[model samples]
Target: MTDRREWPLYEVFVRGKRGLNHVHVGSLHAADSTMALRNARDVYTRRNEGVSIWVVPAAAITASSPDEKDPLFGPSADKVYRHPTFYPIPDDVPHM
Candidate 1:
């Protein structure tokens, strides 16, 4: 049996039938991508709540740190044109 410590960590994402995008569910350890996918399906969708599954190696993911939030995302805050507040919402528009 392979030692648990040697297994690579995987991040699992699942998309439900009604959901338009995949959401992060949890993490697990697996020996390979195939195993990781299978494990994610069994672990996350036992009740068949999900229509799709995605397993990504934890090592392959690059994430921004909270400390770098200002430097990374602050620039976008100044771009007021990016927001749709200037547009008038018609009374006929539903859910606007």
Candidate 2:
């Protein structure tokens, strides 16, 4: 049998039946992607709450660090056009 310690870490994302996007659920160590996906489903969706599961190898993910948030995201703060504050919402708009 393969050693558990040799397994690679995986990040799990699960989409609930009522959710429109896949949310990061948790992480696990698995021998491969298939096993990671199965383990994620079993661990995170035991109650049948999730409709989809995605497992990505931890090393495969590249994320910005919180410490660098200002330098990375600060430029976007001055882009006022990105915000919809100037628009008036109509009553007929469902989610607005």
Candidate 2 lDDT over residue span 1-96, tens digit each: 865467899999999989999999889988899999888978899998899998999999999999999999999999999888899999999995
The segments of candidate 2 whose C-alpha lies over 4 angstroms from its true place after superposition are 1-4, 78-81, 90-94
TM-score of 1: 0.79
Clashing residue pairs, candidate 2?
none
Q: Whole-model lDDT for model 1 versus the true structure?
A: 0.93
Model 1 lDDT tens row, 1-96: 865566889999999999999999999999999999999988999998899999999999999999999999999998999888899999999985
Q: Ten residues in a row with the worst lDDT in model 2?
A: 1-10
Q: Highest TM-score: which candidate?
A: 1
- Candidate 2 local Cα displacement, residue 37, angstroms: 1.6
What do the candidate models score in CA lDDT, each in turn?
Answer: 0.93, 0.91
